[model samples]
Target: MTSFPQIDAVYETHLPVRDLDRAVEFYHDTLGLELAYRQEARGMAFFWIGGQQTGMLGLWQAGSAPMRMVLHMAFRLGQEAVLAVPAELKAKGAEPLGFEGEPVREPVVIGWMPALTVYCKDPDGHSIEFLCPLPDAPDPDFGIGPWSRWLQR
Candidate 1:
């Protein structure tokens, strides 16, 4: 039997939105994702995740109900950039939240993943994260900490 081809990284993700315009503003203006293209007739828009020719995120206008299952998506960033995302979001009137939706003052270190991450929500209530691998994280186990405290230690 022939073996299946190896799978690579995710190329794109399709998310349902109630209003294409609003979604576009939130994703492009607020989140800083580049607008790749749009299909107004189909009520759909696409954004370049990291670069113009890199990964893409598609937004389809077809939902009225609130998101039933919370979807989590993370964007990779440098350590300084990850730590700076929360302040930038707040300055743009976006709420930076913790894992449980609590207001966050800093990014949290995910002990298991050994990564620093900060969370927020998009206009459609989808969970968004900015993450970076912790360079000096403990080898065996390092407890999670807020960015402020984590930086001090």
Candidate 2:
């Protein structure tokens, strides 16, 4: 049997956007991602996800048709920062959503992943998640709740 080489982690992801400039504004201005560079002729832009040269996300302009599938992208953040996402997004005129697409009043804990997560949509309707794993999270089981409530338990 042939063994496949071990893969480390995702290096990058490309997303389709209707307008490259708008996508750049949201990612670079609103989401606070650093603008790596842009290719005007190609109608594409790249943003640094974590740090300069650490991770990359490419946004390619999709002329007319909408994205075939709404993509979900999760970013890992410090615990406190993850907890602050809802308010932060709201302050920037964006609505924070839960996994069910409902307004997120507080961070939700996914017991299986044991991570505290908050969701929101980009200008192009792509789902984005900010998450941080809970220290000593309980064994995987279905769990979701407001951060205050989850922490109490």
Best prediction by lDDT: 2
RMSD of 2: 1.8
**What clash pairs does model 2 have?**
none
| Model 2 residue 121 lDDT score | 93
Identify the runs in model 1 with alpha carbons over 4 angstroms from their true place.
1-8, 66-69, 138-143
Can you write out model 1's per-residue Cα lDDT over 93-150, one digit (the tens) per residue?
8988876778997888866667888889888788888889887746335566676666
Worst 10 residues of 2 by lDDT: 136-145
Against the reference, the lDDT scores of all candidates come to 0.82, 0.84
What's the C-alpha lDDT at position 141 in model 2? 49
Question: Which whole-number lDDT from 0 to 100 does residue 129 have in model 2?
Answer: 91
lDDT of 1 at 75: 82
Worst lDDT run of 10 residues, candidate 1, spans 136-145
Global fold similarity of model 2 (TM-score) = 0.90
